[model samples]
Target: MIIEPRSVAIIGASNDQDSVGYALVKNTMSARCDVFLVNPNHEEIEGKKCYPSVKDIPYEVEAAIIAVPAKVVPDVLKECGEKKVKYVYIISAGFAEAGNVDLQDKLVSIANRYGVKIVGPNCLGLMRPGYVNATFAPYEPKSGGIGFISQSGALVDAMVDMAKESYGFSAIVSVGNSAMLDITDFIEVLDQDEKTKVIAIYMESIKDGREFINVVKKAKKPVVVLKSGKSERGAKTALTHTGKLATDYSVYRGAFRQAGAIEVNTFTELFSVSVLMELVGEVDDMVVVTNAGGGAVLASDYAEKYGVDLIDLRKETIRRLDKVLPEHYSRQNPLDIIGDATSERYWKALDILMKEKYVKSAFVIVTPQLMTDVDNIAMVVAKIKQKYKKPIVCSFIGGSRVKNAIHYL
Candidate 1:
């Protein structure tokens, strides 16, 4: 109900333009559902009548976004329960993360008595593009295939801005403090969402380790995890941030492997792997065709490190490539066609590699040289990508020279 509510009430609505309450009201005004504002201090905000409480609303509210003070959360949640609201998202802070365990416990107790699911006591709320923007994020993300659940709300804000042009999201959730519902709950829900092709998670700690592994193992879609708190100091910092102690990094890594989840070290790898998985599903036999030998070598090293199989070229495949590529071109899996190669060489080399029945996907690397036609090569790559309907991750290596080509791809 919280992810896509039919009707929602914004508790603690305010007129102060800089306040979180005001931001919540403003962001949610564009949602496709009914939105009601509540504030005891104001009669109306932006010409809309402000109810004193959830009890004052005339109709049923499927979800309530609470942005009130920490001390008032219990009362506000109780009122939501009396009004039969199924979901409540506590956007306010100063809960367990602030060492206020008693206050957090009180809110949780009230929620269970009313059979309500709480999203957070310290979080940024949720967002479903083109449906609802239930967050204070400065920029709303464009709708696409990735469903991202993060412990750090600020990181979600950053990702929204960075991915605006490169990729998009099906939904964005910030699981703050995890007083009631955790990352596992969101993962289970998003796994069944047809629009979400892949699930990406930025986890600080796990509330229930056994349950997390079970959920990921049974997930039909791919699960990519970016875990933090690897160092002792980092784990302590995570505890202060989310009120949950992160276990040893090795333990979490082993668990992820056992559950068949892909674990990435950096944010760049997280989405790169996700986009690849979304487009190609899984590839057992892969190859790299690059104009730079060094780039191919680096790719080979990483492929070995990450367990990606870069299959060797067969004799027949090499013979076919020999006709198109220069005689001196490297004939192995990372088929380096020499740095000075032009777009035609790239087109022919990629065409031959993609046609091999044994080859499933490819990585095409292009380095800017004096003779390289960066823009034309990008067009050729785009054409080949459409023709084969196979995954082709491109690395247009260089600054201004390759910028246009990168954008075209």
Candidate 2:
């Protein structure tokens, strides 16, 4: 189901400026995909003959991206139903989230009867950068690593934007309102997919808690989750919108841990875990190294919350570090080297840390004023491949001057 599409029909196809239809057509064409434009009144849109309806299209489409108004969705879906399309991306809005539980029931009902898997009635849709794209959020990343699933449109767009600037993604999925098919369905499908090595998700709620928990844990692949909507205000908003969650924060947190998934608090942290997953694979323990003691201490404190052991280097290892690391540096779990360390010193420490027995993974922090030669440090990090079979994540916290030099070169 990843990329075996013979053709796709874009419902609500139009040539109007700034139309989602126009953007979708452009994006689809860019991928050189066989496309059919579906619209009742248009003769042609973007040089592609506009079929009056999905039924009129000669070829069978495996997927249909419906961009028409929500009111007309059922009719459009009805047309797709007759054609027996397997996958439908309902990009229109104003469904269950509009406070119509009855309508929501009807939507789910139709999908179940027809054997159609729906992404959303109010979603941006999924983007397969490697092949098929169901979204119109404007992303053309150098596709390679971590796949993304999110609920919010703005956030989904942000993820695409951030990926282009900071990292590469295998795919990006937008889960809005969860009318029928939700994140778990997508996760189940992607877990078996060969192209996707890692999965990062932004979950506000789960539709199938037990199934979802079971699927993710059994995936045996690196999965990073950033669960939001925990506060009273957030809970009220989410509950009012999605009908609420019976399980509380602690319950969800425990579920993530038992499933062997790393649960991060923020979106940036989620992306951080995702980016590092490309380098580090399935870490059971971590070593924290930072130039600032306070920052290192705080990081170690949070590391304990996930049951990830902060393995301190042994006395033998400390003796080796003492031979190389400066006098003021602490050789323990949160290895704190004072402010005077340079990129050379950081590289040496990294070289030594890679040799340490207990450290399965490590996080390096270098603040703005920590040092110069940021390019040199980036080179060192890029050079240190997964030769030792451990994941290494580096965070560049340097000042504005060396910001570009800090992250990957």
Candidate 3:
């Protein structure tokens, strides 16, 4: 109901331009649903009628967003329950994370009594592009394939800004504190969503380990997790951040491997792996097509370290490449097509490599050599990718010179 609400009520909508309440109202005003603003002190805001509470709205609200103070949350939640609102997203802070466990417990008790599901007590709500912007985030991400669920709202904000011109998202959720609904619940929901091809998570801790494993094991789509709090100092910080203890990293890693979820170390890897999985479902045999031998060596080292199989080129595959590539080019996996290669060389080499039935994907690496046409090579790679419908991760390795080519790809 939260993701595709037919009608929504903003419980603490404000007219003050600087308040979170005001931001919620402004961001949600464009949602494709009936929006009702509620505030006891205001009769009208921006020429629209403001109700005193959810009960006064005179319409059934599928979901309600609570942005009031922590002490005031219980009463507002009870009002939502009375109004039969099933989903409530609390954007207010000062709960368990603030050492106010009793206050958080009170909200949970009221919600359970009313049979309501809650998203957060200290969080940046959620966003479903073109449907609803139930968040105070400054940017609404472009609609795409990844469903991002994170414990850190600020990280989601940062990712939104960084991914503005790059890949987009199917949904973005911030499950802060996880008082009632945890990361597993959101993961299950996104796994069933047809629009979501990949599920990316930024997790600090899990409420239920056994249930999490079960859910991930049963998930139909790919799950990519970027866990934090691995160090002793980081664990204490994470505990204070979400009111949950960060467990041993080894235990989590083993569980993730058992459940077939991809565990990434950094933020960039989290989305990068997710995007790759979204583009090409599951691939094992990969080949590297590069213009720089040094780049190919680095790729080979990483592939071996990560246990990724860089398939050995067959005699026939090498024979086919020999006709197109220069005689000086390395005639093996990570087919280095020499540093002084042009777009035509890239086109020919990639065309031959992608046609090989044994190759599942190609990693095209290009260093900005004196003769390298980065932009044209990027176009050739895109064309070959489209023609074969195969996954190709291009690494145009350079700054300034490769920026436009990277953007074009």
Per-residue alpha-carbon lDDT of candidate 3 for residues 2-107, written as tens digits (9 for 90 to 100): 6778988988999999998888888987888988999999998877789998999888899998999888999999999999998999999999988999999999
Query: For candidate 2, which ten residues in a row score worst on lDDT?
Result: 238-247
Per-candidate total of colliding backbone pairs: 0, 3, 0
RMSD of each: 2.4, 3.4, 2.7
State the lDDT of candidate 2 residue by residue for 366-405, as single tens digits: 6656355667766766665445656766777646755676
Candidate 3 deviant stretches above 4 angstroms: 272-282, 304-309, 322-331, 340-345, 371-376, 400-404
> Model 3 Cα displacement at 337 (Å)?
3.8
lDDT of 3: 0.89
Off by over 4 Å in 2: 2-4, 138-142, 239-247, 289-291, 319-331, 337-353, 356-359, 365-390, 400-409
How close is every model to the real structure, measured as TM-score? 0.91, 0.84, 0.89
In order, candidate lDDTs are 0.89, 0.76, 0.89
Candidate 1's residue-wise lDDT over 54-163, tens digit each?
99999989998899899989999999999999999899999989999899999889999999999988888868888988788988878888989999988988888888
List the candidates ranked by TM-score, beginning with the highest: 1, 3, 2
Best by TM-score: 1
